[model samples]
Target: MSTVLFWFRNDLRLHDQPALHAALTSGATHLLPVVCLPAPDERTPWCFARVGPHRRAFTAAALRGLQQQTTVLGNPLLICQAPPAAALPQLAQAVGATTVVCEDIAAPYEQAEIAALRAAGLQVRTVWHSSLLHPADMPWPASDLPGVFTSFRQKVERAGITPAAPLPAPAQLLPPLDVPAPVLQAVGAEQGAAAIQPPAPPQGSDARSSFPYGTPGCDGSEGAVLAHLAQYLARKLPHSYKDTRNGLTGLDYSSKLSPWLATGALSPRQIYADLKAFERNHGANDGTYWLWFELLWRDYFRLLHLQYGAGLYRARGLSELPLAQHNQRGFERWCQGETGEPLVDAAMRELAATGYLSNRLRQVVASYLIYDLRGDWRAGAAWFESQLVDYDVYSNQANWLYIAGRGTDPRGGRRFNPTKQAQDHDADGSYRRLWGTA
Candidate 1:
């Protein structure tokens, strides 16, 4: 009986999971699935005061969901709290596994870990999953990638980009591999470890959380995705998506799929397909189409990171715009949600309280931090790193740079007037009352 190890990185679900399906279908009788929780580097912005409790709570919730799914499917997910470079190889050796399978991650940390594993003489296989549309499926050669999204979209449309249908969950999970768990006290969490629960749903959840914890299997499965989309679309809410997308308060205004997408509970392709179906069922309009637009934006950010890996991580900034003047006091105020602008302060407070902010507020706050407060965009990005349940390295970093005039936005820089924005988005002062006055 051959043993194969399946390492779960960001892709946590069983459905539409190409790598997991491959691992189970590889004719290996003994299969091991592992989840690793890496320790935070105290020096990194994400480690400092940046990573807030809200996103952490959300991650813990999703992990619990994954564990339950894995258990029922046969191989219980063994949790480790060590860096991937250390934990994965150890697991492979313990199980006498011939090969380790996982989804390919283009992020720097993921790339480095994979390199380390290969260097250690382990046969590692990686599959690209998560994107609604795979890069390989995109028409243009990655090297010839368009400088802007419009070109990429046009090229893909011209070439007729078609998404591969999501793979089904393995009907029979391979028998569990017998392996000793590694000692991972330094990294904090151990196998079957529980996360620290938050006081509330989370900042974003509170902003839009009519749906609370439903059942045990509600977090990381396609079933959950179907449930959410069905209820949301059934209400015909997507028809108002464009109008309410920028709203700061209430559930119906936002799609609230970030947490699921971030943890692989839902795939981008799943969302795309659902939107197409909704359009057909409920009349295609700007609202129905906006959902696809948002997914494209998500894909655009992912591609940006793939297209410019290390550059996105540099302190000099991604777009490398004119280094804005730094104001430490202003930066602090912004993070603390005390910017004196009710809208900015409310958004920051909401983030502090729940670890989520509206997309509209995210742009507003980023603009104020960079242009009005004259703070470095890197600092704003770092702040977001600390917060945001849906914080993907590519999306958050690239977005901050875009607002600060450092990234791909041809508009150069966006300077938002906090007052005007508050008046425009929260005219009734309802959002203001919820988070408190600046």
Candidate 2:
């Protein structure tokens, strides 16, 4: 029987999984689905463990949830502790497969992984489905995308562009390709995910943290995702999201959807579909409209990656700006929330504690690192990648560049005055007090 190995990257869920669907329809008789966990001890150049505890807990939950679904479908997910370049070739050989199908990530490191697999003599088919709208459906070619987010959003709106409907989870995945235990052992594969140990099943033990992921509705599982979205819409929360989105310390203020989106546990299309249904049922308003606007911004960052591939990851992004000198001491202090800036410190503390942060605070802290502390934006980006449970590479890189005046930002760069920001967003000081940064 012919086999096709389906590699799970960031896109982890079954619902709205076009890539997985591609593998199912590829006519292979046996399918081996696998996800190579980042090497358990991988370190970023910043001399830190790349995946922090909270992101690990959330991602582990996602893997387990994915494993449970595939198991019920009669195909099991194989979790590997080695890198894809090392494990995939072995798995392919074990199953007698020469083909791999997975999600397309625009980032440099991810693209390199695909290259390595191809180098190893595997025919890799990458399907791009991470964004709300596909590149092909855009009003203008993504390659010639308007250099500005506002213009891009305007053009998309002028064309009335909307994401196509999301796909349902396949009722039955192709039967699992049976790999002998010796082969699995050689590659350090954990069948049915029995070997993976998430720090805590759902979350860390911090109660004061905004995202309380350990709480019943907040874990990274698909079951929790569906329930979270259902309850979010059932409460009619989207209608008031824009107004309350800036709140510093509560889950109710934001959609709290990024973690799921980042982990690929939830689909952006699923969110857009539900938001539209909400508007049709209750009529449209600015609050409901803003959520869609935010989704469009998410798409804008993805398209930018297509427009400029490795350039976005460079020290100075798309612009000719000189690299900002990284302040080693200042960055270390900032990461520890010891920068002595009350609002910024509080936000950093919150991020370290919960693996989540508000969008406003993210921009503020990024600006503080870039403009105030004179720190390298890349270092800040790496710190976020290491800490954020909701870290999406596209948005994170684009944002750091935007603040550092290195990307296509028309204003050159964005700098939020943290003092004024504190007065504006946290005048009551309750948020700072909550994080012990007051």
Candidate whose TM-score is highest = 2
Residue 434 CA error for candidate 2 (Å)?
A: 0.9
Q: Judged by lDDT against the true structure, how good is candidate 1?
A: 0.73
Strongest candidate by lDDT: 2
Candidate 1, clashing residue pairs?
Answer: 50-386, 51-386, 52-386, 132-269, 203-354, 319-406
Clash totals in order: 6, 0
RMSD of 2: 1.4
User: Which segments of candidate 2 are over 4 A away from where they belong?
Assistant: 191-195, 198-202
In angstroms, the error of model 2 at 169 is: 0.7
lDDT of 1 by residue, 1-438 (tens): 689988888787777888988887888888888777655433454236544565556666766667777788777777776766777777777667769999887777678889998988899999888687888777665666677778777776678776777676677688886564334343334533744333343323343332232333234344566687778888998889998898777657888787678777787777777777888877888887788777877787888777888777666655554556778889889888887888888888877766677888889999988778888787788778777777777688788877877777688767788889988988888888877783
